[model samples]
Target: MRVKSEIWIRAYLRRCQAEGVPAVVVRRGDEAAGAIFICVDRLDGSVALYGPAPAGIEGGETERRWVACFKTATASGAEVSAYLARQSRFDSDLWIIEIEDKQGRHFLGEDAIIE
Candidate 1:
């Protein structure tokens, strides 16, 4: 069985703190099975959003890593924020994590993160 969503998120936050990277849960979702979205704040007025990897097609590879879903140009932080806001409206159960790191290091678990 898969781990609970809240448990996974808490562990992720702890890892971020241990790494000395500022991370916050912008929005909390269902404790058991909410989808997770991560926003990496590059600290340069730009942000990148990563979502859970998509499922594989028939006969395709099943294992996948987090995938980049959105990116804002330099100095477009507002745009990224607005985009996230819209997403929240659409999916209230989605968990949003904002990581403030110049290098955009989300540390989303190496085995499950491709980039």
Candidate 2:
């Protein structure tokens, strides 16, 4: 179980809030978490949503919840696509959505669909 460093999480949250997305931190199993979770960000010149490969992603409550947090950050409409697509290394089962997160706040907007 790999928990995101406090520095990283805080920075991420700050950045998201600054962008008006207001980065949210939720425990992995928290009901608030969506089914497909992601850790959203931008690497280089594009957007990215990352998560630990689900292959053997297992652990206790704390671990599981953090993992969930990681995933939710990148899920649909969370706005982390192009950066992930640019990754030269990634898992096959990893759902790299094509839609980018834009300024539209509509529920299930065009960017909400999984790719």
Best by TM-score: 1
What are the per-residue Cα lDDT tens digits for candidate 1 across 23-97?
A: 899899989877788888887777877777766623214322576665423336786678778878988898988
TM-score of each: 0.78, 0.28
Q: lDDT: which candidate is best?
A: 1
Per-model tally of clashing residue pairs: 0, 11
Candidate 2 lDDT over residue span 1-115, tens digit each: 3344444345545655565663455322222222223444332333334343344334422343222222333334333344344432342323222222354221222323333
- Per-residue lDDT, model 1, residue 61, is 41
- Segments in model 1 whose C-alpha atoms lie over 4 Å from true places: 57-64, 71-75, 111-115
Error of 2 at 104 (Å): 9.6
User: Which residue pairs does candidate 1 place in steric collision?
Assistant: none
lDDT of each: 0.74, 0.35
Candidate 1 is scored at a TM of 0.78
